[model samples]
Target: QQQVRQSSQSLTVWEGETAILNCSYENSAFDYFPWYQQFPGEGPALLIAIRSVSDKKEDGRFTIFFNKREKNLSLHIKDSQPGDSATYFCAASPNYNVLYFGSGTKLTVEP
Candidate 1:
């Protein structure tokens, strides 16, 4: 079974609005979670990350909310803009190496 999973296939949000992307994982050994964003034709880039010791992580307009007990997490994009439109992936790593990625969620930010 896949260790990481993303529930939404796509999400749409107007400019300046917030977009929420949900994800879950099955491995308790997974401790580090990172969200990656990829523009069309470009490779995924690490956007933000959170550790099991922290429930929340924020970087600029991106934030991650993690639930260690539920083995789930969510990425929140604030003040979303058209440039923020991309395919977002939720990834996890147990030993800080060999990441397992979710199916990904396509986020379209409309002006």
Candidate 2:
């Protein structure tokens, strides 16, 4: 069974609004969580990450809120822009080993 899961297939946000992408995992063994952003005809790139020991991690415009007990996490994009539109994937690794990726959430930032 897949360990990581993304409930939403797609999400839309107006420019300058914040977009929240939700994710969850079934494996308690999973500790490290990383989110990947990918554009069309391109490979996924690492956006931000959080460990089991951390409840939150933040980058420039991206932030991750994690709950170890709930086995869930969310990626918040502040001041979403049209360029921020992409397919975001939630991935988890156990002991820094193989990574399991979720289906992915497609985000569209409308102007």
Candidate 3:
């Protein structure tokens, strides 16, 4: 069964604007949420993450807004750039090691 879901398969944003990627999960047991960013020919890297206990997490230009009660989250990329174009995956885990991923959202930052 698919435990995670991304609302859009692709998203486009103009440079300097904010790009939002949305995700939701089925299992309430999923406590850790991590968003991974992948560029062409490169493996997905951990972009940012949030625990169930917190409503949000931020790292540099990336921010994850989480809603525990709703079981949904959104990743916001501030000041979108052409170099930020990539596929983003939203993943969840009961523990840190094992992750269930959503169908990725391809982000296009137009310059």
Worst 10 residues of 2 by lDDT: 91-100
Tell me the tens digit of each residue's lDDT in model 3 across 84-109: 99999999999657899999999999
Find the number of clashing residue pairs for candidate 2.
0
TM-score of each: 0.97, 0.97, 0.96
After superposition, the stretches of candidate 2 with alpha carbons farther than 4 Å from their true spots are none
> What tens digits encode model 2's per-residue C-alpha lDDT throughout 61-100?
8999999988999999999999999999999999966999
Q: Could you give the candidate ranking by TM-score, starting with the highest?
A: 2, 1, 3
Taking all chains together, the TM-score of candidate 1 against the true structure is 0.97
lDDT of each: 0.95, 0.96, 0.95
lDDT against true structure, model 1? 0.95
CA displacement after TM-score superposition, residue 99 of candidate 2 (Å): 0.2
- Poorly placed runs, candidate 3 (over 4 Å): none
Q: Highest lDDT, which number?
A: 2
**CA error at residue 19 for candidate 2, angstroms:** 0.1
